[model samples]
Target chain A: DTAVSQTPKYLVTQMGNDKSIKCEQNLGHDTMYWYKQDSKKFLKIMFSYNNKELIINETVPNRFSPKSPDKAHLNLHINSLELGDSAVYFCASSQRGGGSGNTIYFGEGSWLTVV
Target chain B: SQQGEEDPQALSIQEGENATMNCSYKTSINNLQWYRQNSGRGLVHLILIRSNEREKHSGRLRVTLDTSKKSSSLLITASRAADTASYFCATGSNNDMRFGAGTRLTVKP
Candidate 1:
């Protein structure tokens, strides 16, 4: 069974469209995160939630929002998506927040294409 | 802005050889982790080195962190074709985590 899984593995939307990617973790983790890997392969953190509480929100644009309904789920919603928003989004979970020796598990990634 | 940046961008190695990649960061961190991502797949955690630690090892992988230099390195021993992937170094801070641009490694059969 997959420890962390995300839906909408591939998404293609026109500019200004709204879209959402759903993520879930069965690993009994308390910390969940959203990371985006751009065309240049630079992986950047977007948001982090610990036990369904928003903890870290990077300099991501206001068009992007992350919601955690519960400790096991974290969803990303994008409004008015732009061409620059096209990238691979990954959902990950860790047993705890950032600290020494806490391994984070990543999902298979959701590829978003904004045209 | 990205905190860590990998050197050499890309590398090609022959099977049975060893591959090494380096990463440099701009700020302090609690720990540094190395991850591997096969083409079009998710990233898999390889190894982690704490700020107080100098080196750590896993099955066929070894990671070393030099907090003083704000850098880290990953070494894969006896590499196989299956080891072909992009390797990234992620630095974890109190607030969040940051990943490098990744080093694309190709292991020739």
Candidate 2:
């Protein structure tokens, strides 16, 4: 079974458009995260949800919102998509506990492009 | 902001040669991890080394951590073309993890 899966693998929309990417993890993990990889391959954490509760919220713009229906799923909604929002967004999950040994499993990532 | 920075942004090596990537981070960390991402693929966890541990090995991949220097290095021995990928170093405390820009490696056969 796929450990972590995300939908809308490829998305291209015009500016001011809104879109959503859904993610699900069958790893039974408590912590889930949304990461953005820029064109230079720099990965940055945008948000983290533990057991469906917002745990970490970076300085992401208000246009981007994350929703977690359950521990197994976390979704990202971007409104007013701008050109700067073009990047690869990844959904990752990990067991919450015992320090940094918790290995994270990442989905295939959703490629978002705004023009 | 990104906390870790990987050195030698890109590397190209011949098959059977070794490729080494180094990472340096700011502040203290509970542990450090190495991950690999193939072109157009998801990131895969390679190995994790705690602040207390100095070195760890997995197959031909060896990871060494130097907490005193706040740096870590990943060495891939006998690298093959299949081993070509971007490698990232992540440092974390208890619940938070941050990744570096990553080193792009190409092993030519």
Candidate 3:
């Protein structure tokens, strides 16, 4: 069974359109995170949720928002998408308590294309 | 700019040879981790070394962390063709994790 899973493996939409990506973790982890990898392959952390509470919120634009209804699910919604929004978004989850020594499990990733 | 930048963005080696990649981060971290990503796939966790731990090993993978210098290195011995992938280093402070650009390793037969 997959530990972390994401929905909509590929999404193509036009500008000014709204889209949402869903993520779920089966590791029973207390923390989950969202990351974006651009064309340069530079990975950037967007948000993190601990036990359904928002933790780390990066300097991402307001158009991008993350909603975590619970510890096992975290969804990302992008509104008024721009051409620069084309990239691969990854969702990861990790157990709490042990810190960095705790291994993180990643999802297959959702590829978003803004036309 | 991204934290935890890797060196030698690309490397190619024979299947029997060893491969090493280095990463340097700007801030002190609680721990550092190494992950491998196949082409167009999600990352696979390889190893994790705590700040107090200098070295860690798993199967044929070896990881070393130098907290004083805020750097880490991953070495794969007796590499195989399956080892050809992108290796990334991630540093975590608290529960937030960030990854480096990663080094693409191509192992030929």
Which portions of model 3 show Cα errors greater than 4 Å?
A97-99
Top-lDDT candidate index? 2
Inter-residue clash pairs, candidate 2:
none
What is the C-alpha local distance difference test score of each model? 0.90, 0.92, 0.89
- With a 3 Å backbone cut-off (N, CA, C), the pairs that clash in candidate 3 are none
For model 2, residues A1-115, the per-residue Cα lDDT tens digits are: 9999999999999999999999999999999999999999999999988899998899999999999988999999999999999999999999993245899999999999998
The sequence of per-residue lDDT tens digits that candidate 3 reaches over residues B1-109 is 3668887799999999999999999987788888899988888888888888999999999899887888889999999999999999988676688888899999999
For model 2 chain B, give the 10-residue run with minimal summed lDDT.
B91-100
- What is the Å distance of residue A85 in model 2 from its true position? 0.2
- Minimum summed lDDT over a 10-residue window in model 3 chain A is located at A96-105
Give each prediction's DockQ, rounded to 2 decimals: 0.70, 0.68, 0.63
Error of 3 at A42 (Å): 1.5
**Candidate structures ordered by lDDT, highest first:** 2, 1, 3
Superposed by TM-score, candidate 2 places the C-alpha of residue B34 at a distance from the truth, in angstroms, of: 0.2
Clashing pairs in 1: none
A1-115 in candidate 3: lDDT tens per residue?
9899999999999999999999999999999999998877778888888999988899889999999988999999999999999999999998972255788888999999999
* Cα lDDT tens digits for candidate 1, A5-110: 9998999999999999999999999999999999989899999888999988898899999999999999999999999999999999988865446788999999
Q: Which candidate should be chosen as best, given TM-score against the real structure?
A: 2
Docking class of 3: medium
